[model samples]
Target: MQPNAESVVVLDFETTGLSPDQGDRAIEIGAVRLQNGVITERFQQLMDPGRRISPFIEEYTGITNAMLADAAPVSQVMAEFADFIGDDNLVAHNASFDKRFLDAEFARISRSYPGEFACSLLVSRRLYQDCPNHKLGTLVRWKNITGEGSFHRALYDAEMTAYLWLAMLADIREQSQLELVPFELVTELSKTAKKSVGAFFSRW
Candidate 1:
């Protein structure tokens, strides 16, 4: 049988700003590895981005400049993260943002992952179109997923995204009546158009 929610990494990043091209950098990263629909391992680290973060970012993520003062350098952290990844497929709430930073940071360390990324946000949008919005927090509430802690912090957000991913997988399996939902199916569903979503599932 193909791997379902049994093996993958859900990741989140706290960044200094939006775009790396605009000199932004990831200040922290959090990821959790799932096996058999449960998290079996975790990776979290705060990196020193070698510059002062904007007051807004500091306020937003609650990762102060003071906290980053003595943290490991981005290159060092990225190298360790590359090892932690180790060919695992990745998931993120809004994956493009995290993927961009992952790529940028990997480039700095001359490292890359062969695994693909699946965005929980995209899959949720298709599965839960009636949701008020697709933001991580919104979906957590909309699905009644157990949300015990805070958001914005890399580890906390990654944890929440992990649970949300599991919830979506369960829903898809129950609704689609499939014994297993492959990573490829989730990736394909993310690309399926809204209007064609029902047809997409029907054909599956």
Candidate 2:
């Protein structure tokens, strides 16, 4: 996949807790579909996890227990989200967390997606080592990415992640003199040593 030339979905999830394997479920899901570097579609949903959210999680995400009282169940929302993601590559800030919830929720619905997942967090650690930190809010401010919503909420975080993804692609294109940034290059950069990163791109 040429990340700069094709459709990609940037996604974020606000969960009832941290670990999906430990019974934490997604309380909210927010995603944006980007095509050719422009956001073309958006998805956001609040789901009831059939369990009560703790005070810590509620305060952290600003999503109250009452807010989820009438929300849809995980199975229904996951089905729709799976459809929204149809065959497009997926990006998330910390993808392992999101991927766990996605896999668990999809398994409950007997659904699956074929797209590869990328972590903007891992990529940012490689691309912007000078930044004080690689947190979503920090990178958003450091990169001057516009954000329309509050932090810890799914939608706004997803928007910021989309902008970060674009900035990294722009950086690579500028540094490598490439017309388009390939998906493989971004993933490779995430794993490549910082000292040899520039040379690795030149070899590409």
Candidate 3:
């Protein structure tokens, strides 16, 4: 059986750099657990990557090296994060980026998650084609979703992404005239051709 959008955890990561392969590490992770479409729990942590973050990264994410200097180590943070994740499915905007870091960090602790991941960015691209773009902030403005008036921070981005994910699920249900929108259908929508999206819905 497929999970509902209401029951997944929405997560975001702020990292030292783009790829883990390049020795980049996640300095922070923020996530919210949704139950029946309401946020029931939250998790946020900043970890010491054991290296000074670049000036550009510091400016871009507003996460200073000093802020991370006293934080817990990566292994401790990831182990706690793993407990927070438990068995829920995951959602993230631009999930590929977050997923890479998540997998890399989990590997450090020899941990793994069984839940599937869904990309709000990909699903939004297919669902909101008329929108100028599908970036998390842009979608918040387009959909009139309330935001905390900040971006690039881990928890705030996860919060916005969570709202955006819910909006897309609502759009799908309203447009398809279906009462329930399965997580499987949302993932499928991400892969459906743009021109054939309407036809794809009919098949459901």
- TM-scores, all models, native as reference: 0.97, 0.96, 0.97
Residue-wise C-alpha lDDT for candidate 2, range 1-204, written one tens digit per residue: 455533589999999888988989999999999998999999999999999999999999999999999999978999999999999888999899899999998998899999888889988888898999989999988988886779999998898899899998888788878887777777778888878877887897
Give the clashing residue pairs of candidate 2, or none: none
Question: Model 2: residues >4 Å from true position, as ranges?
Answer: 1-6
Find the candidate with the highest TM-score and give its number.
Answer: 3
* Winner by lDDT between candidate 3 and candidate 2: 3
lDDT string for model 1 (61-132, tens) is 998999999999999999999999997889999999999999999998899999899999999999999998
lDDT of each: 0.91, 0.88, 0.91
Show where candidate 3 strays beyond 4 Å.
none
Residue 48 in model 3: lDDT:
92
Please provide the root mean square deviation of candidate 2 (C-alpha atoms, Å). 1.3
- Stretches of model 1 off by over 4 angstroms after superposition: none
Model 3 Cα lDDT, one tens digit per residue, 1-204 = 667767999999999999999999999999999888899999999999989999999999999988998999988999999999999999999999999999999998999999999999999999988999888889999999886646999999999999998888888998788787888889889999999999988888
Order the candidate numbers by TM-score, best to worst. Answer: 3, 1, 2
Q: What is the C-alpha RMSD of each candidate to the true structure, in Å?
A: 1.1, 1.3, 0.9
